[model samples]
Target: MSLQGEPAHVLIVCTGNVCRSPFIERVLAALLPTDAGVVVSSAGTGALVGRPMEPLAAAQTERYAGSPAGFAARQLVPGIVDSADLVLTATRRHRGEVASLHPRALSYAFTLGDFADLVSGVTPEDVAAFGESGAEGARPRIRALVRAVAARRGLNPPLEASQVDIVDPFRGDETRFEAMAQQVMGVLPTVARALVP
Candidate 1:
């Protein structure tokens, strides 16, 4: 998440980038502090690069805080995985893609809901005990949060299906897309509030 005290960077990945990843990325960006300098970006394991978000997902984001005017799908790259502090994949398959590409990333990377489940168990005291490296900006606090969650690797209980993967809604099914959006919207704000100071 950091090198030389830089802001934490998050990379979200899905199958096509045109749907779930873009929607989730924008929502997280909107939830975090702009000044905190948290970098949130999305990509696809097999992305439709240069394509805008799928219509159904775009509509969902519009209902929230994102604008479809500036989104473009992109394929995942090793560099993106290397730079990310937290790599949240839309599915276990996507997470496997990231790990197979970079074994060292296995610790920091997770499925979106998997990450939520892990972080949900981290109490405020755990964050405090991770050490305060001067309480000014969010980078330290965020790093602490990530560290805390990472520490819970084997300690926390396993996750249920609904908390480990977001169903892809790119099949031209608006109803499925809405359900996916609800899942993401419900989880991301809690994550942002925990990591953002």
Candidate 2:
């Protein structure tokens, strides 16, 4: 419960760690707070373990940000899933896979885009109010917003269940990957704020 001192460990999941997951890992690592003591890592359910990221993904990552340098594909291990304080996946199916592996780990796995949905509900008014109140009140406000969005969309909240699935980009061309990356990047700020702040 106390993520203090001990780094807030996050594990990102994808079908192959060589692509989207690594991309996300790098992006989050670059953007998320370093002083918050959070560590971001990535893995794949069926990854090649020691393989390097896909060439296109690696190239795009360099162009986007230089954080994922020398990243090699890693297979999703039970211990990793169990140990992480947060687990994010690239697809709904990947969330399910993680859940099945560690049912107790359900609270952590969430789609990158779904977190955006939660953030969308936080209006400028809410942000201003939160700034005045402080971080404790801000957290409850964020949780409330997540619930409101989930109810309106009739989607189960990922915080309560391992259901939010991000769009998959496997085998897709550069264009599709770019689109997916955009979607993921859009939510990074929100996630960083929530997890680190």
Candidate 3:
């Protein structure tokens, strides 16, 4: 089921798109419910256009049950922001960039780590209850869920400065990629539950 007459769209952003964003995109895609028809994609602020995921990051994605096949980086554009129902960026800086690209998107755009943390306290029932009056199905429920999470932004601050950004591991070793993957995977289940529950 879909809201807005189409599948719910989630966009992930990073600097180069070859490491952080692509890996997160694939993992998040795999995590989302297949029947929900959620569309997950990624782009870069300064993309290495046409490049594939960084080898180490791709390996981590595979380790975590995500496929990194045939991926190519694309530069972030305004339309991408406009189409996204939810935008999860690698860092706070990327969140700001998305806001600058589309001011209206600010309400639904968040740093990936920040989103995970904020949504941690939001249970599946809260999301379903939000759209209970009229909106039904996973798509509307997800839309309501994103809005619900966004509403909690000012109420709960991140525990630490580091809890708000996924560190770029593009130029790092396998260890760095592993750490990055851990950070991302740590929060995805919370997001998936809200979106697909």
Q: Model 2, 127-161: lDDT tens per residue?
A: 44534243333334434333343343444344432
List model 3 lDDT by residue over 65-99, tens digit each.
99999999999999999988899999999999999
Q: What is the number of backbone collisions in each predicted candidate, taken in the order shown? A: 0, 0, 0
Q: lDDT for each of the candidates?
A: 0.83, 0.68, 0.85
Runs in model 3 lying further than 4 Å from the true structure: 1-5
Q: Runs in model 1 with CA error above 4 Å?
A: 1-5, 131-136
lDDT of 1 by residue, 38-83 (tens): 8889999999999999988889988888766689999898888898
Candidate order by lDDT, decreasing, is 3, 1, 2
Error of 3 at 13 (Å): 0.6
Compared with the true structure, model 1 gives a TM-score of: 0.89
Model 3 pairs whose backbones collide: none
Candidate 3 lDDT: 0.85
> Which candidate gets the maximum lDDT versus the true structure?
3
Better of 2 and 3 by lDDT: 3
